[model samples]
Target: MERFNKSRVILMPCRDYDEEEIYRQLQVGIRLLGGLEGLIEKREKILLKPNLVRKAEVDRAVITHPAVMGALARILREEGYENIICGDSCGIGTASRTMAGTGMERQMEKYGIPVTDFSHPVKVDYPQGHQAKQFVIAQDALDADAIINVCKMKTHALERVTGAVKNMYGCVCGLQKAKGHTLYPNAESFARMLIDLNQLLKPRLYLMDGIVAMEGNGPTSGDPVKMGVMLLSADPIALDAVFCRLVDLDPQMVPTNVHGMQYGLGTWKTEEIEVFTPDGEVSMEEAVSRWGNPGYRVDREKYGKNIWNALKALKIFQKKPYIVEEKCRRCGICVESCPVEGKAVTFKNGRENIPVYNYRKCIRCFCCQEMCPHKAIEVK
Candidate 1:
């Protein structure tokens, strides 16, 4: 825990997803973090975990850019690390399909990195966990000596911002991820569980692709807005804190950032983080001044246990997901993705009819919103 007393984060400006450019910038960022030699062994089994939420093109900014992943793989291979794999559990479909859809499968083939659906869930007990004492982790993750989290920067309906910390939720195999919402329905509890998972897995490094980030309603369904930045760090919390700063969001308002500090995952306190660029060490304020997007469309309101959340009967007062009848494709993915008992969303009218949400059963987990392929569901 004391190792997190002071954390270093490297922030670099990236205009686009040009493979060569990303490779060069990543090389500098890794070097700034004292290189991977001292941290990861050359022969150690490594897992390059990317945020493959679901099937979508790279331009959508829904998942981590394949170019970033390929560049990281190329760098590792250059470092004499031949044993490497890339994997993630997609939110709504097979990992293979999502990988192919996002052009990640092609990138992996180019780098000779095997892709896993993160199959074979293994029960791992973590008594030290403050929120979750045990977890069912993917076998690939459990076997890896080190994990390099390659996550995307996007707004999330549940967590506000899904960056380095929340990215690890994909470590939970397939349907278990949906079930997790049932276990930890709210942002605070869910974030505590995420902190526990990070503490348990202890990924070697965290990298965020922020050149183009999703905004409005995101994590999966949202519009892409160019932010022109990339972030890297050993501490997920500090890395995410820098992400918060770039979007003009208060890091303290993010549940993961708050619980991460309390549970010793890493520090979000501005004083405890050392943010820098290739020029020299710079203040968080300076980092924002250079690449910050004060106009970025993210929920900046403080999410406390207030009347808004407490008054469930007043559904109109809360931020709940509603279907845009015109956009609804009647795919029933929302119905299938709902983790609540008896299903919060169902085809109440008929199989051919649009699914309806029983708000009474809805946990406001936003699984329906997150998994909706069409831009039908939006929380307002």
Candidate 2:
């Protein structure tokens, strides 16, 4: 509603997650936003929602870097805010194990903070939504006194780039994320739904771990590239718009940001965005030229809606998941996460525990591809 301070964003140069260096940088970034003095009062419980998407090491950049988050937590602790907890509803397993695997739990535990699973969720109604009318949101998302959405900068197969706005999708709890994909199958429709979710969650602040970000096909399944910058924002839409610019991509092509503007989420125009760094306020163009990725971007399928819808009806998009037998550990997670009523991918093919996908029944949501920890499932 406030328009993310008219697209004002703070950019801080951070090359690594070294304990001391990152702590100082985070302080500077927070101070740029008026520090905790203006934002949070002492003793207020703050929820740190980091990107713990399917439990990968921080080096992979699939989730927010643990060191970045830990340092921020410590900084907040020193700022007189002691009650803190890190949480997310992971894709496949419980939140506790995912936190442990991604190396977030150890850092958080160091600061007397507990990692809780947003497992138990409550249903919410959104009559004012553009495409989404109702949702089941994580109770922790609703219960937190304030939410600082700590997101990883990455490419998403569905939404193109996964940034601050897309990170809140984790607030919907586990498999329900799959249900969301199934409910709103088209990219435009799903992006609008994400806007609805963001409005409901209403994160007060946004922070990004861009020291190393995932490029190409990601969110999971991509290579990490050195971007070496941390970002802070009051508005996610504007934050994402700046990010799209940094990556040399058109922000209008990013669906969340496109729909975000229509929903009054935040500004999507980079030209209108006011960027700041230690050197002082910088123009968006200068910021991009100085600290931007010209050659890196997420993969996006090129097909107009009419063409895509035509092919989609015929199931001709052909981006269906196929398991690599050797890489497959027969975990059955893909089978479990499928939102189809009869289960699109099944273990009923009767070959020990290996699963098979009946592509005809599949919705092509890539839930299987996204959840596979072993990288056994590949979509073509």
Candidate 3:
């Protein structure tokens, strides 16, 4: 197993999303990874998989900054890499809506880049999978000549941290994501599925948007905190491991990277990684010393987590979604997002204004909470 395959993760201090500056730094990052030509080819199809999970303002740091996407596109075009397409299968909403809300629509229109909704997928087998024997992924992701994962750096209620490895979950498409949450409620099983997805995709490059990251309960619901750094890598697991280290979090506690290691994805060892910054390469100790303890972080806990997660998965125990009566707008978005057959949550008296949750039928997937526009849903 070449899990320790050496790769470079370049860190650049980028404070703002000025287009020209982003373009310049991206080039520097690419050069550190042995130049774009070394990773990509001339006139090949490239997919930019950004994390635009739901409708949100760009400054909220819920999605990849459009400036970063735009600048990367420009650099790719200049390097003769054409036919660049962007897309993601969001957890809470449609890709089109998310892209539009995250200011990606404007950039896509400006650059004449097409947005694939990732609604359609083809089933693919993964014989080595520990959790998933097979997977249904967006066709465009499979068809692309090369994939460049433009991931967001954030805290997740389940995965501890969402970085390069967890970003691939966007490939699962539509309601399958919810189904996955229902099937593998525990972080361990869920992370195995994530590792399988990444292994199947085998993206050529990974770029993390860490300029402004989310802390507390995140991936969807969390507050934004500025870390003001850009991370570029060819190894997804290594990239995630480094991120965990920088934040003074345990890489092993992060399920995606932990399962990724068990399955021979990439290195988690600090000594195995060679980190490059604008100035030059730095030792892992130096890198951690400078970037460790960002003041605020999402702590990953593992004590009795697997057992609790097992109970949650079996429905022996569940954290059901509750609607804040005052905050509920009666939009029916939560009802629509629910994957349950009869729908786990519904409107009271068919008034279409207030929401009602049927606790018994609920899968505890948290799709409603993940999708709610008004922050009206709570899991209790």
Candidate 4:
């Protein structure tokens, strides 16, 4: 395995404002990487894996924009690459539901592309040995001739920023994703796991859908900012570094970048990276300036100290669930999901059956947040 430097990042300015025009720009970006000819052999089965985190409208900036996928599929087809498919596993639901709700199925149908559920998984080993012994990956992803990972640029609750590298986690399948979180509970460990996964299942090409990126608290709820730029790279780590720089975020602060550099995944320093723009030539500073900072506050000292204290005061770390009385429908889902021996969450006798959270034994895993159908649970 060879290490990738910053020189590998290719940033292409999308002059086209409309969807069709944007697709043309995407074709130019891929052309710089030897086009889809060599990358995708004629008639080879190709999987266009996009980040469908949840079933949200494209305008909401939660999942990968269907237009982007539509554009990519069209380009690939033009190059004589047939047998195209699109799929991903959403966090809170099944792939089929996510595809239907997000209108990805319609997009695929428009392009005559097939949609497959990446739910059935098979175990694969990581001989390099970064974190876990092996990972369970969706069989469809593994069987594809090549995977074109189209990831949305967004900030994540656990990983800070989720880009090309983080997007590959979709290959792990659906419910199995929760199990990975359970295995690597902490942020740093989880990042290491992602690095290992990326190495094991390396995609043939990587593209960052930065036209509209999510900032602040994201991968779910966040403000959508128009970045007006797209990036392509053979190296996932380098592409992520470029994305962090464009947003004025420190790549070192991103756990995946840090661990990836340490393990020979990609470069962390900006000076060593050589950036190529669309119009033949442009200064790195000029291209980066076009992407204005999203103004995200990262309190390093406070966050670091708090995490350390929380781990140290494990037993005393109270997980309080503040129920919104107005929103509570007297449902007992919280009580049912509580794993504590003494039943930390219990329904009150006569008061709207309001469930009480006992902080003493709660693990703070936020399972209550996932199980609540009415969005009534808030952990603090």
For TM-score, the strongest prediction is: 1
Question: Per-residue lDDT of 223-302 in model 4, one digit per residue for the tens?
Answer: 67778777888778878988888877778888899898888777767776667765654555776776546464321222
Worst 10 residues of 4 by lDDT: 294-303
Clashes of 2: 0
Q: What ordering of candidates by TM-score runs from best to worst? A: 1, 2, 3, 4
lDDT of 2 by residue, 64-156 (tens): 988888888899888778777778898867777887855578888888888888978889999999999999988878888778999999987
TM-score of 1: 0.96
At residue 13, give the lDDT of candidate 3. 67
What lDDT, from 0 to 1, does candidate 4 have? 0.73
The Cα RMSD in angstroms, rounded to one decimal, for candidate 1 relative to the true structure is 1.7
lDDT of 1 by residue, 1-380 (tens): 23334699999778898889899988998888888996799889999999989888889899999889989999998899999988888897767778885668888888888998888899888998889988989999989999999999999998899999999999999888988899998888999999999989999999999999999989888899999888999999999999998899999989999999988888888898998787778998898898999999999976455776666445556679999998998988898899998998999999777888898788899999999999899998
TM-score of each: 0.96, 0.92, 0.88, 0.83
lDDT at position 350, candidate 1: 95
Query: Judged by lDDT, which candidate is best?
Result: 1
C-alpha lDDT score of every prediction, in listed order: 0.89, 0.83, 0.80, 0.73
Local distance difference test, candidate 3: 0.80
How big is the positional error of residue 295 in model 3, measured in Å on the Cα after superposition? 3.0
